[model samples]
Target: MAISEIQSVAERPEGNELAGRVALVTGGTRGIGAAICRALAGHGASVAAGFSHDRERAEAFRAELAAGGADVTLHRGNVSSAEDCRRTVQEVVDAHGQIDILVNNAGITMDRIVSKMADADWYDVIGVNLSGTFFMSKAALEHMLERGSGRIINISSIIGQTGNVGQANYAASKSGLFGLTMSLAKEAAFSLKRAGRLEAYGAGITVNAVAPGFIETEMLDSVPEKALERIRSEVPLHRLGRPEEVARVVRFLAADASSYITGQVWAINGGQEM
Candidate 1:
């Protein structure tokens, strides 16, 4: 489907499933991240969208959400830095009261064959993609744990699971998230247990990852045309996945409907990896 049509579709058709929730999405100004912000906002969640740069895109994101009457606020910060992540979280908490949901969607790629990959390239990708997730998750954990609940959803990738030829650093960072997800999930479980609130897996809080493959986002623009065609041909659906499709999965995980689940990696690929 065309992106415009996907954009027009109802992001929260389940009827305010996430009412009274507050969500922070990093790298939320464009592409999959933007779609996630709109989806969460549409579901009745007050959204705090974090962007490192690109003021024009950030303004447009605000406008899009405003047009739909979504409670979305824009926050500017670099996810790769611990201080910025903490500041961003605090600013949102101070304004919105609490962080009910955290979407670690901010990521970057400095692609190159491992042999030729510069040290800076590797560190840059790892810092933003992996370390950013850690920083944001840690910062938001304070409020979430105190409230006795939360949903931390990390945006991973197919490349992270199935190795990509020219993305060693990216793959490693994404793979690291799986371990992080499980560790955090169990930590939350035990912490709640210590507080004598040993409820079901999702009752206390949930930490999960959503890995997408070949989605229609600006990130794909960097791919060679032939490679993009190859990806499309491999997908059983014969097309790249839309950002909305991934956002819907995120919306579900954020809502009470997904309370019974946590620490799972949900793939949004069109059968590309499977």
Candidate 2:
């Protein structure tokens, strides 16, 4: 299908479901992260969209979001750095008073077969995709622990579950998120119910992941046309997933409706098998 023929999955948010909530979405300048940021803001959350670089695009994204009536700000930082992650979290809390939702959406792909993979390629993908999630989650959990309740939504990939050719490093990094999700969910539950210093979050907290497959985004621009067509042909839904479709799922997980769901993976893959 032509890109223009693909339907949009824009939000029709209602009831201010996330009103007064404060959220941070890393890699929020474009693609899935951008959609997630807009969805949260549309529901009345104060959002901080973080980008690693590309000042021009980030500024453009900021202006577009501002025009949409969102209470949004932009944060620039590299999530792979523990110190940077700590400072980013602290800055958000300092500005917004508290962070109730943390979407670990920052990631990258250094696709290569194991034999040909460079040292930097392996470490770079692992650092940004896996370690970045941990760094951000660790820093955010501190504030969430003290606050008594919170949400940590990790953005993983379908490759993590079933694996993929030329994606050894990517697969490993993403697969690691599932373990991290389950572990953190348990720890947060412990802190909330028993070991916690703050009793306000006795209501509990949640940590979950969203693993999307072949979303229609510029991320796939580098893929060859024939390969892309083959991917589309294999999907049970007969098409690529839309970014907003995935964002809606993230929004649901962030909302009160998903309060009971945690340590699980929600695959948004157009019914496609990994």
Candidate 3:
């Protein structure tokens, strides 16, 4: 099937029965994160979207989703801080009772070669991408384990797998996320088995990652048109990916339809890896 036409198997099975599930999407005020929030809400999952510093933008997003009749709440917090991650997760649980899905989508890029990279830049990127995922996952796992069911989908990148020229920090952080996914998947399974809920979550709480490439978002707006055109030409599909395209993959992983999958990275790069 064509990439754009690939629909997640989850939505097809549950239909609208997802009404009671709660989802949290970090950095969800805009771009790919926003798309993920919208798609999940549309499918009946109550969504909580997080933003770092843009109160106005975050409020606006809440209003937009609400206007469309989506059960969405906005939370302001920096994912890099463990305190913020804890607070955000608490807010979601407080409002919704439990968190069924957690999307670790907040990340920042400080593109520079290793030789030219500043200590501050390296630290900042690692703090947000690697440490942030760790903190959020740790916080969310508590609730997921108690409930014996949940989904954690980390947003990684093609650059993480196939090294990029000027993103050593980004590549390392994303590569680390893959390792985190595997370890957590094993831990989650063990915990479920101990709780005697092994079958309940044999496919119950799956942790996965979605790696995207050359997506069209504000991050790439600065690229010259010529450069973007060249990138599109190189892709096997000859196109830059849309944020919604990545969001669909996230929606699938978050839903029960993906019950049997975990610790896997779904690359939405239009064959770039091949």
Score each candidate by Cα lDDT. 0.88, 0.87, 0.89
Q: What's the residue-level lDDT of 263 in candidate 3?
A: 89
| TM-scores of the models, in the order given | 0.93, 0.92, 0.93
Model 2 lDDT, full chain set: 0.87
> Which stretch of 10 consecutive residues in model 3 shows the poorest summed lDDT?
1-10
Residue lDDT tens for model 2, 72-178: 88899999999999999998988899898999999899888989999999999999999999999999998988877789999999999889999999999999999
Ranking by lDDT: 3, 1, 2
Among all candidates shown, the one with the greatest lDDT: 3
Better of 1 and 3 by lDDT: 3
The digit string of per-residue lDDT tens for model 1 on 1-274 reads 4655443332434768788899999999899999998888887999999998888889988998988998888999988899999999999999899999999999998889989999999999999999999999999987788888899999999998898998899999999999999998989878878987665433468899999988999888867999888888999998999999999999988876676788999998988887
Per-residue alpha-carbon lDDT of candidate 3 for residues 1-274, written as tens digits (9 for 90 to 100) = 3433344333354546457799999999899999999899988999999888879888999999999999888888988899999999999999888999999999999998889999998999999999999999999999999888999999999989998888999999999999999899889888888888877323378999999998999999888999999888889999999999999889878877678889899999999889
Top TM-score hit: 3
Q: Could you list the CA RMSD of all candidates, in the order they appear?
A: 6.8, 7.9, 5.0
TM-score of 1: 0.93
* Prediction 3 global C-alpha lDDT: 0.89
